[model samples]
Target: MPVNYTEDAFNGLIIDTNTIPTDSVEFGASLTNILAYSAENNKGITWLTLPIEKSHHVGRATALGFIYHCCQAHELTLVHKNQPAQFVPFIPSHTVGAGALIKNSAGEILVVQEYGMTGYKLPGGHVEQGERIEDAVLREVLEETGIKCEFVSVLGFSNKHPYKFGKSNLYFICELRPLHNHIQILDTQEILDARWISLADFQRDAKNSAYNHELFSALFNLSGLQPQALENNKGAHKKLEIFFANHKDGLL
Candidate 1:
């Protein structure tokens, strides 16, 4: 029997895994029927999502030409093109990270030395799923170094290809204002040391990357991008944060 399915906006069919049989032989037969039915009905593509419990059926689906698409903690998604002319949607291909560039009135920058890594670098980490960029930076900074800060502007961003797990990485350079001067180590495991270093000392250090040097050198003239409030704060755009070019204030 053909498996239960639903047509998505792109006319692709999303198979209902709950409706599939537990037995591999039965699933193979049902999937074959579904593919035939989809082709006959001119469907665009077929999405097969199998839970961890139905892992046995993965081989059966692959034998019928389903390619690996993406997966989650407890499930896997496979896709097969039914319509030769239709295009498959691109999966998320980049991980977002944020680095905080916090400067105090003493002209010292807050830097941290991560475990297994040499030299001091800006404290940051990967942005969690459904997390705001500003919030992620603030959280990482506070977690790595016990310091409260307010978001300033996005100084710049760097992109590195073939990063962790073969996904591209987007590292945003965020300028922040320190709320307090006290420095305490919070994430003792990941961070080795957290302290304030003068701008002159940071620039003289050979351990710092050229990108970091340029950012600091051009700091006085760069205004960076600042997040602006949206006029239409409803529906899909409500939670979205838009960064606009900063004109009035400079970083220095």
Candidate 2:
């Protein structure tokens, strides 16, 4: 009886081809000859068969080579296929999040420590469906910190690590001013603690926590703090520079 190849079987055969040594010319020639013979015998394959496979492999190799070259040229750490990239789209999940940087009269920045999360982050939360990002930020801030805020300017954006929460993108850096008189913080399930700290204090806590270093750095740069302060704080400034640099390339 003739060998029968199902779709899955054919796919497995193709995968098996990957293990073939690239340096073996005889192996390549033998595989090519066998594929040609199989196509001729099967009569199901057409003129496009060999060309299509060749094209696909060539294109894939070319793409991979280009990526490798770019990473080498830029001195970037190359991620393998199995090692997922940061901020990549995961399974479909609805996640609309936003954050704000609020400065008080005493030059303190507003930050909140969530009950479950490890780090102290800025006040923000998921943007509900049919809600604008600005509105979401406003609502989240009020709900978390018990302070109404007026939107000022946009700082930047960031994305969550891939393979987590369906690869959500978190919109960070919307400047805001307080509006309410009584700073009566409402203790909610989402937030455990809230407080305004000096920029230095915020930086210290952020460094200690597993917070997004790049995002915080971008926030500091956008704040336009004193040059002396920024220079004195090398870690903060370095993080900011890296964030801004990544942000620029992402835009392009």
lDDT, candidate 2, 139-218, per-residue tens: 88888898998865567666675523225556556778887534556756557778877767666664436454445555
Tens digits of per-residue lDDT, candidate 1, 97-133, equal: 9998888998888999877666778888878767889
**RMSD versus native structure for model 1:** 13.8
RMSD (CA, Å), candidate 2 to true, equals 17.2
> Clashing residue pairs, candidate 2?
none
Note the Cα lDDT for every prediction shown. 0.83, 0.52
Which pairs of residues have clashing backbones in candidate 1?
A: none
The TM-score of candidate 1 is: 0.61
Worst 10 residues of 1 by lDDT: 83-92
Q: Candidate 1 at 96: error in angstroms?
A: 0.2
Off by over 4 Å in 2: 1-94, 161-167, 180-182, 206-214, 221-252
